[model samples]
Target: MTPPKTIRAAAIQVEARVADIPWNIEHASRLVDEAVDRGAELVALPEFFTTCIVYDERVFGCSLPPENPALDMLKEKARRHRIHIGGSYLEMRDGDVYNTYVFVEPDGKVHRHDKDLPTMVENAFYVGGDDTGLMETSLGPVGAAVCWETVRTQTVKRLRGKVGLLMTGSHWWSEPGWNWARGYWQRFHAGNGRLMERTPRTFASLIGAPLLHAGHASVIEGGFLVLPGTRLTAPIRTQLMGETQVIDGEGRLLARRRYQEGAGVAVADLQLGAVQPRAESPPRFWIPKFSPMLYFQWYHQNAAGKSAYRWAKRTGRLRTWDDGRNARAAAERL
Candidate 1:
C-alpha cells in the first residue's frame, strides 16, 4: 500500500442566509478563490452552505434532486479552480430529505455521503442519510462527517485507519447564553462541545488522520429566542456562528478562524505521509440529556407515526417551516 500524499487544504467560513441560494453560492465561490490564491489544493465549505436551513413547509418545497442546479454551480467552481472541493447540501431523494456531503475531484467527478443522523433541531428538517462516508482520492483515502454527525461514536470509528484526511462541515449555532456556556465548558471538559471547537481535534486523534472543519461565521437574524432561565436574566436572540478549524493526525491545531474574527478562510498543510494510524478503543455509547426532540424523533420513526408522516407528505401538511410561528409549532409537534 502507498503512503498518503501531503496536501494543502483550506476551510472556508461564511454566514449563509436561509433559502438565499445566490448570495450563499457567490460568497462560497469567492472564498474558494481566496483559498486557491493561498495555494490550497483542497477546499471545503460548511454544511448547508448554499441554504442554511428551512424547517417549515419550505423544506418540503426546497429539496433538490441529485442533479440539481446548485450542484452544477459547485462542480463548475471545482473545475474552474482545478482543486478538490468538499461541501454539503440539502438533497431530496425519493421521499426523504438528506444532509449530504459531496467531494468533487479536480476533474469535476463528485462523490457523496449522507449524514448518518440529524442533531437536535435538525431532525425536524432532515431525515438521516446512509453512506460509507469514506472515499478514495488522489490525495489518498478521505472521509467525512457532517455537523452534529461528527459527535457520533460510529461516525469516526468507521473511518479509523481507512483515511488520511477527514472533512467535517458544520453550522454550529453560537450565541450568548446557551452556546457560550457550552464553549466555555469545553475548554475544561473534553466531551462538552462536540459540534464545534472540539470535533476536528477529536476526530483527528481517533481516526488517525488530519481533519478540516469548515464552519459558519456570520450571524443571521432569526426568531430563535433563548428564553429566560436560571442561567440568564432575560431572553436573548440566538445566533448561529462558529470557527473554521483544522488539526493534524496528532490532534494538534494547525489553524483556526474564531467567531469573533468574523468570516475568513483557514489554510493548513496536511502531512498525510507522516500519519501513522494508532489503535484506539471503540467509543462507548453516550446517553444525551433528555429532550422533547428525542422523544419526537422516536415517535416519528414508529409504525403509527410513519403512516402519519407519509400521509402528511402526501397532503402537504408537513410544511412546518412556513414562518416563525409555524416553525415553533412544528418543532413542538415533532
Candidate 2:
C-alpha cells in the first residue's frame, strides 16, 4: 500500500508523577482521547509515560511485565480508535529491565524498539537494547527513539535514510539539585532549555524526515543518589523539559507546546516522506555541545548508576511486576 502524503499526528506532553503507573496511564489516556478528537491518526506519548523515572529507590518499583497495563492500554486505544499510538516504558524481561518503546497499529499489530542506551541515573534501572529503532508500519517505515537518543548521532546513523517519519519522546529534566549553586544551575537549565526547544527541528533536518516529539512537563521532587550502593541521598527538585513538537522533513516547526505551557497535545498535519537533509550530521557522538558540568555528570552518574544497578540485582532488590506475579503463582502451586 502506498503511504499517505500527509497525516495528522499528535505528540502528547504529560505531567507524569514518579512511580505512579496507574495515575500516569489515566492521565495519558485522557490526552490521547483529546488528540484523537482533533483528528490525529497517529499519537505519540512521552518516554516513561507509565511512570516518571528518577534516581530514587521507588524507580525500581516502576518496571512492568511485557504484558502489562501500559501495553494493554495502548493496544486498546489503537484498536478502539482505529489509529496508531505508542509510548516508551520501563519493562522487565528475563530478570532485566529495559526502556522499551511499544507502538501499536490500528489492526492490533505491535512493534517494539528498546532504547539503545540509558541516560544519566537511568543506568541504575535498565540496560541498553541492541535493536535498530526502525519499524515497517502499515503507514510507512517509521523510526522510534527515546529521550537523549534523539540528540545522538548514532541514532541518525541507524535511521537516517531508512525512515520516512521519526517518532520520538523525552523525559529530560532540569539540572541537579544544589541549592548552594542555585544561581549557576538556574542559568545552566535556562540555556539547556533553549537548546532542547531546537532539538526536534534540528534532528529532523539531520534525518531528513518529519518528526513527532513528545515529552514530560512537571516539577519533580525526588532524591539524588549520594553513593552507588547506599541509602544516602540528597534532595533534588527539578522540572521536566517539555518540548513537545511537530516538525517537517525540512526542519520547519509545524506545532509546539513548551514545558511552561503544561501538559497537552501538539498536533499538526505532516507531509510524510523522506526529504533532502538540511544539515550534516556531525562526526561526534552527541549532536549538541555539552557544558563541562553535563559532560562530568554523564560519565560520573553512568558509573554510579551502573554500580547501584549491580548491587540491586545482586541483592535481589530489583523487584518488578513480573516478580510479584511469579511469587503469587508459586504460592498457589505450593
Clashes of each: 5, 0
Q: What's the lDDT for all of these models?
A: 0.68, 0.89
lDDT of 1 by residue, 187-263 (tens): 42332333457666766787788888898865554322122111112233334556688788888899998766767
Candidate 2 lDDT over residue span 218-327, tens digit each: 98887776775565668888889999999998999999999999999999999888887889999899999988988988887788788878877888868785565577
Q: What TM-score, over all chains together, does every model reach? A: 0.77, 0.95
Mark the regions of model 2 whose C-alpha exceeds 4 Å error after superposition. Answer: 1-4, 229-231, 322-334
Candidate 2 structure, TM-score to reference: 0.95
The lDDT leader among the candidates is 2
lDDT of 2: 0.89
Worst 10 residues of 1 by lDDT: 224-233
